[model samples]
Target: MAPTAALLLLLSLASVCFPAAAEETLVFVTVLFRHGDRSPVRAYPTDPYQESSWPQGFGQLSQEGMRQHFELGQFLRSRYGNLLNGSYDRHEISVRSTDYDRTLMSAEANLAGLYPPSGGQVFNPSLKWQPIPVHTVPQSEERLLLFPRNDCPRYTQLVNETEHTEEVLNITAEYWDFIEFVNNKTGLKNTGVDSMWGVYDTLFCESRHNMTPPDWVTPDVQQKLRVLKDFSFQIMFGIYKRVEKSRLQGGMLLGEIVKNLSKMAAPDPQQRLKLKMLSAHDTTIAALQSSLNVYSGKQPPYASCHIFELHRDDNGSASVSMFFRNDSGAAPYPVQLPGCPLRCPLEDFVRLTQPSVSQDRDKECQLPSEGRDKEILLILALSAGALLLLIALLLAVVCWRREPMAARGYQHVLNQEGGGDDS
Candidate 1:
């Protein structure tokens, strides 16, 4: 009822409703989408889910994929209506994808949704929409884009660092047992299958597109593969800590990122890139997220998006908020930087994502067969095989032990009844 109290209350309400217009802040959105419906990426020679089985041949985005992307574009349109123009502005956004057809097409479908050509937006009247460019690099040339790349300097260096420390290697007899068991069952040479997130990401992408696995892949095999995926995620997170130490720990990348961000925030900011959308496999998302020091222990599902919104307070202090959009959860997951509240300081944000620029990504993200050293990684391979076997045995033991005594008793009773009847 007091005038002073009423005035303070009004001011607080005003700030809540019209907080410093965050409009000046450049919204950087990076979206990672699995390719839409498609045939299997690669079928084993004996695979039943070959190209012929699908309406589209192997690795082509399906109509469902198109709709998913289109809807996503609509979502973007709704979210950033003001930030976007009445028409598509090439300068406002840059799109990139892996060179695979499905990926390229997925990008197109996404663009169709994100930047549907309207009246003048169209190239031809007959067509409802026009082509918006989706950029890509040759798969062979894109080392940083590949998975399980054997030549990641950061990864190699980390291994060396950890290996140098006697305690971290932690090789044990149990490990050898695992290696031997795996070598016996798979018939493949001793190989360390540590980097499986990428393979799983690619496979998951294919499955989402309706690609089927070969009959040779039993349910157990699928489950093991999923475990490998989880392990790969763990490895990814471990590798990131190493990377942070090398690239971002000193606040070097963080500094650069902050500088670029400042430029982007400038009155004459780099209008060259309004929105940057990166369409990559789930591993790519995992890798970046891990580096950002936030690993949720799960791979992002199809069309998962991470958005960084920048804002400036009334006094012109920079801040950022990170949002993750995944399929399963009803709401976006918000992550804030350490020293900041719900929103983080921009300097920290830059520092976190800086590892991407620090490493020679071209060499690190490459496929293993090409970039990997040929020095017969036998010892490690054998050890890995042994470790896998140990894991299998441990899992088996756990399952067997969990069976209740009642279950065994019932089985014994059935066996006795069968034997008596036979006699």
Candidate 2:
């Protein structure tokens, strides 16, 4: 090979392999994380422990959850300390959480670790924490961070179809006995592979809290349940048609994140936000990762975080980097977009993700025209059948009235003939 050609090849490889560290600067960061450890959302009917057994009741954050989010906050501060101001600035950072108590409290706990009361910002000498605003909307109203939105009819149809797929059918058949055993043990009539997660979640939480589970919930049972739980996540977000499922469910959030990144990249002086933190459920992370085609095929652990870092080069070129931190003790894992470089250019990132993001969600969520047309045809057929039945009943009634009139006329003639014979 010519020396010039080799040199050019090296430069091209360098650009793809190395981040433009010297020239690149972090302009904005979006950190999405699952709420930390919490009590079980609910218990099976036959479970020994109920909501009252938990100190904070079911589905609420526990002390350990607080510690986890606090540590995660500290990690975020260390990672983006240079970008974020040392003190809490509402304008510089925005935090949003699901309306659930666990998520809202997790955000608050994280903010404490990210920005402790410093210097003049301290209102009380005894407390090191300062109040930071964490915004939220009702679960029904939230579309940006929630997963498997129930309002989309097409998405629901996809889910129903996914349950009947061969892969799912075989799995369910393989575990039929086990599922029935759980049904008998838990007194849950609706125990199925798709809903096995609730059982696992309840047992896992109990085990974590040192509460003894039933004898049937052995280590092996726990492990198997874990596998099914993870598979449930896949069924919800992938399994049959992942991309289409993502476009309906996770794409909403992905579109919003991209929009924010685009806004940050724009040459707008009013773009003051530096960090956007979202505290949500494991399902949220799973859905987003599925849309990105990077889901790890496991349930997102408590306090697991996904980061989107937007960087700008000295030449004003923008790129996006993704990282997943599932293990608290380990550094975050760098996620390379399937078809893009590790440091994906902003334009390429948007283009590659376009399939997952819906331009018109409601329109796309409607049943296909063919399906709608068939439904209309069925309805019209039923209406026409009903109208014909009504006409047939009216004709039968008119014929019955003529039969009675004919009988009266025959009777009068018979009486007249009998009278003539008597005279």
Off by more than 4 A, model 2:
1-22, 369-371, 374-423
Candidate 1: worst-modelled 10 consecutive residues by lDDT: 245-254
**TM-scores of the candidates in the order shown:** 0.64, 0.83
Top-lDDT structure, candidate number: 2
Identify the candidate with maximal TM-score: 2
Global lDDT scores for all candidate models = 0.59, 0.91
lDDT (Cα, 0-100) at 370 in candidate 1: 47
lDDT of 2 by residue, 218-261 (tens): 88888888888999999999988899999999989999999999
Displacement of residue 183 (Cα, Å) in model 1 is 8.1
Candidate 1 lDDT (Cα, whole model)?
Answer: 0.59
lDDT of 1 by residue, 1-423 (tens): 999999999999999998765444545544445555444455433344455666767666667767766776777777777777868888888787878877787778777777777876777878767788888888876543344344455555554454334432343232445434444444435444453333444455556656665454466655655765665455544443545433322123233334556666544454555566656666665655555666576766656776666666545667777777775235667976545576777666655456535544444444356455543476678889999999999976875566555655556556656873222
